[model samples]
Target: MNGMERISSFIDSYIEDDEGLLNEILSEAIKNRVPVIRKASKEFLRTQLLIKEPENILEIGTAVGYSSLYMSNYIKPNSKITTIELDEERANLALENIKKLGKEEVIRVIKGDACKVLKTLPDASYDFLFVDAAKGQYINYYEEIIRAAAKNAVIISDNVLQDGEILESHYTVEKRNRTIHDRMREYLYKITHDKRVCTSILSIGDGMTVTIKLSD
Candidate 1:
């Protein structure tokens, strides 16, 4: 087997799950080669929704609408989600999945570049923002998410650890990934040190950082 195949096999062997559907989806993601949220990250965000019951949520990525539907499962029936995705093929697939899940009314998938689409949203409009799109654009997403978050709003950024790459020295990462790695480190530092936000980095799937806007 190839390197990634071997690695995935090893990881899967150690992964345990009590949630049947989640386990199924995760296995499907690996089998179908779809990118879905990791098990731990998904559960953590689900629990946060249970606690916050956000009136509105903005998701920067909608890969087959897995996470959005996952969030919908936890949120109140009346709450709404606006998710953005750039890939037409994946966007269509996400729409189909959301329809099957009977959450079309609650989750709206916008088709376009997330950064550009986010510009059209009114300021301070979302109670929660999830960043899970292109890794290189995390900082840009962070800026937009911060602008869109309402007072006390929470922003959850997934894959912050980049599979532990962030822990390596910059020179060790591939050239293409170095910039993103550095930028993510800077973003993580900013989020944790910024006085206007209370942030915690949790070692969930890959890694997740939760940030809540503090009072002005």
Candidate 2:
């Protein structure tokens, strides 16, 4: 394996595997070709949640509730997760899964486009925000996320690297994907350069960026 792969494997080796229905959900997601967080990305997020212990979490994408339920495992008791999904089918499935897992009270699936839904949330409402929606809308979502985030909030954006495409020249990307590539680059630039947050881009999973908002 390559260096990063080797490191990921090593880290996963030490991390205990999830048990029971959670493990089953993850397997089912992978089997169905649903895009959930990578193992490495999950581990990274687990660590962050453990440290932050955020009471209110906002997630831009809820794909079958895999990440939401997975996060429910680590968050403090009585903590709340607000997740958005544009696809009605997926949102219904996610709500079903959340109920099945007995997390219906803890995780609420917002059925709507995140771009519009985010605007309705009260300002400074969330202590942690996770963005994993349509890559092209990341910049747009970022604007609302920042507005809704509390001071010192942690913001994690997944798939920022676009499977390593972010590092390549825009001309090198496929024509259909170039818009997403350019927008992702713009999102990365805006987050990293914004003085209110300190951001770190990591080459884990498809690639993830972690940002902590420093101001209101």
Candidate 3:
């Protein structure tokens, strides 16, 4: 393994394993091939929430509600999370999981396409935004997310690197994935260049971007 791999492995070795019913369920979901946040990304998010202590969070994708539940552990009391999922099965599962955790009052799962659901949310409603769905529509999501975010909001975007393919030329990407690749690049460019946010792209967990919204 290279230097970065070695460093990641060392960090993984030192990270404590979570022991709880929710974590156990998350482990099972991962074993079943459900897409959840990677270890590094999870750690980054945990730290961010601890520092920001956001009162309201908007999550664009609720795969199995794992990330939402994981975040619930870190946010301040009375904080709320609104997560969107387009898949009916996943949305129902998410609700079940939230209810099981007795966090029904803390987390709400909205079943619908995020592109449409986001339009209904009022401006400056969320102090933190997590985007992890429909890579091709990231730019679209970003636009709506900015409208809904509070000034100085923290936006965490996952899978922005497309497994490192994003660094490769567009011609090198598979035709089927070119659209997503191009769109991700565009999204990165906009966030990094926009005066409204200070963005940092990190090579963690398929790549992640952390943006802090700035006042105009």
Candidate 4:
């Protein structure tokens, strides 16, 4: 492993593990090859919610309900999380998991394309928005995301670097990744340059972007 890997391993080593049903859900996701947030990213997100305690959380992806259920642990008892999943199977699995975990009241899984579902949401409805879906679609999701965000909303996007592909030249990357590479770069540029938010792109969990929508 290299320096960054060593650092990440060290950090993961120090972080606490999830217990009980949460741990079981995480294990199931891992066994089924679902890509939930990484250890570093999980801790980062948990801490973010603990600090912000947002009342309304919006998530772009709900893979087996791992991330949403995880976030539910950190937020206030009354806080609500609405997560979207494009895959019907995943959405159903997430809904099942939510029911099993007895989080039906706190977390809801919506089955549909996030791009369309986001349009249906009220403007300024969410205080914390988590984007963890199709990498190429992130740029496409940006406008609706901004419109759905509440003033001073905290927007957290995961996998922004596409596993270290963001820094590589288009010619160097594989053809399969070229589209995601280009779109991710554009997404980064757009969010960082936009005057409505203060964005910080960090090299955590495939890379994460933390943006705080400025109050108008």
Best by lDDT: 4
Q: What is the per-residue lDDT of model 1 for residues 1-216, given as tens digits with 9 covering 90 to 100?
A: 866446655665665563555455546656889888886677789889989999999999888788898888788878999999999998998888777767889999999999899888988889988899988788777666777889999899999999888899999889999999998898898899988899999867788999999754
Candidate 1 achieves a global lDDT of 0.84
C-alpha lDDT (0 to 100) for residue 204 of candidate 2 = 78
Which scores higher on TM-score, 3 or 4? 4
Best model per TM-score: 4
TM-score of the candidate numbered 4?
A: 0.97
Off by over 4 Å in 3: 1-6
Q: What is the TM-score of candidate 2?
A: 0.95
Looking at model 2, how many pairs of residues clash?
0
Show the colliding residue pairs in model 3. Answer: none
Candidate 3 lDDT, tens digit per residue, 1-216? 877678777777776776687878788788878898888888889999999999999999998899999999999999999999999998898898898889999999999999999999999889999998999899998878999999999999999987778888889889999988999999999999999899999988778999998963
lDDT by residue for model 2 over 1-216, one digit each (tens)?
A: 887678778877877777898888888888989888887788899899999999999999998999999999999998999999999988998988898899989999999999899999999989988999899999998878999999999999999998777788888888999999999999999999999899999987888999999986
lDDT score, candidate 3, position 158: 96
Worst 10 residues of 4 by lDDT: 160-169
